[model samples]
Target: MTTFVTLTAYGLADGAVLALAALGFVLIYKATAVINFAQGEFLLVGAYTFYSSFVIFGLPVTVSVLNGVAIAVILGVAVERFVLRPLIGRSPISVIMVTIGLSAILTAIMQLIFGTEARAMPPVLPRGSIEILGATLPVQRLLVVVVAAVVLTAFTLFFRYSRHGVAMRAVADDQQAALTMGISVRRVFAMAWALAAVSALIAGVLLADITAVDPHIATFGLLVFPVVILGGLDSVPGTIVGGLTIGLIKMYTFGYLDPGLADVIPYIVLVLILLVRPYGLFGETRIERV
Candidate 1:
């Protein structure tokens, strides 16, 4: 029972990371209809930026985190203004291809600048364990869960009540209508990118704690796809629930299934979900009028 509890806690932590990353994915897709193949690269960049600022420069961890997030926001805005904005109203395939190209370019640039070697992230949380219900878990893991929850909650509230947040939702729903209503669709796109960047930063930092920083960090962004799909691309709460579901599924795979099954479980689940609930558990269904 204790083992199960421990695994559940760890799974929630992992899910939190997935949920946060997927939130960004959903945001960009919702607003701009871009899949953002480079999403993971943004995360990699943020992790490396944090490493450089804190681990290498010896700056305070808090300061480094702030700087890292700032860089991510700038990168997001730049990408939208330069790369994605130019392709607006173009073919979806073209936009997707551009994102793929952008991913490769970002990866190459980072490789040249940071090199291919894995770098370590400085520990942000205290190194210790907390006991709950007779289960011992790392303090950092709990922190990850708490931080993810807080971030997700804050974003939910922002989108629910804030003016800009409402504007974003309007843009996501119908860009043309949003524009007619005096909302700046372009600015909303940029803000979506900025928010995505921040999500990547948080994911990168938390993931860096568990995995070393390297080019492969970008791959972690891919994990967001299944979560987003499960939650429904347009549903934020669905994303959170989907993330937790996938996390628990992964944990069970690691525990009961063949050790190698962990890698395949997500795809399997994704396929099943698509077959059963094409729009996702909480995703809004589209109605077309001819």
Candidate 2:
């Protein structure tokens, strides 16, 4: 019972981070019709940015977080403006390859800037444990879940009511119609990238706080694929559900099943989901007639 409680708590935290990363991926895909392979690099760069600011420069924690956000916005916009914007209307294969190339380049740059050594994440969250249902749960994990929920809620509201958010949604639904309606598709695209980066930045920081500041954080971003796939690539609400579900599955696998299975379970679920429902739980289905 204690073990179950602990695993559930940790799983929620993991799901929260996954949701953030997957949110970014879904945003870019929905708005720009592009699957950004560099999305994981966004997490990599953001985590290191925070690490560099606090550990290396000794900045205030608040300032360090803001710095991470700044870098994310800059990196996101720069990628969209310089690399992706020009490739608009090109072959999908070309765009996909370019994004893959971008990921490699970003990875290289990160390694060049910070050697491949793993480092401790700044212990920012409160350190302690709380007794819940006779189980001692880490405060950090609970805080992670809370923080992620708040951020995700804020984003949900932003998308629901904000003007720019509406515009982005409009563009996502139908780019041609949005363009005809006087919406700037280009700006929407840029905003999508920037927002995605920011979400990944926050997720990167949270996950690093739980684990460590390591190169593997970037690879962890790949997990977003399964989350988004499970939740529905273009469904915002689906991302959250998918993330939490996957997180719980992983934790349960780690606790009760073969621990090795935890790492691979999400992908396996992804494959099964594809076979059963290719559109995902909330994803829209489109039919075209020639």
Each prediction's RMSD over C-alphas, in Å, is 1.3, 0.9
| Number of the top-ranking candidate, with lDDT as the measure | 2
For model 1 the TM-score comes to 0.96
Q: Which parts of model 2 are misplaced by more than 4 Å?
A: none
Per-residue lDDT value at 39 in model 2: 83
TM-score of 2: 0.98
* Steric collisions counted per model: 0, 0
Where's the lowest-lDDT run of ten residues in candidate 2?
115-124
Model 2, residue 103: distance off in Å is: 1.2
- For residues 1-290, write the lDDT of model 1, one tens digit per residue: 77788888888988998898888888998888889888888888888888888888999988988999899899999999999888877999999999899889988998999899988765786669989889898888888889999999999999999999999999988888999999998999999999999998988888888767888988877878789889998888998999999988888788777769977898788999899998999999998999
lDDT of each: 0.88, 0.92
Task: Report the Cα lDDT for residue 110, model 2.
Answer: 87
How accurate locally is residue 117 in candidate 1, as Cα lDDT from 0 to 100? 91
Model 1 ranges with Cα > 4 A deviation: none
Every model's TM-score:
0.96, 0.98
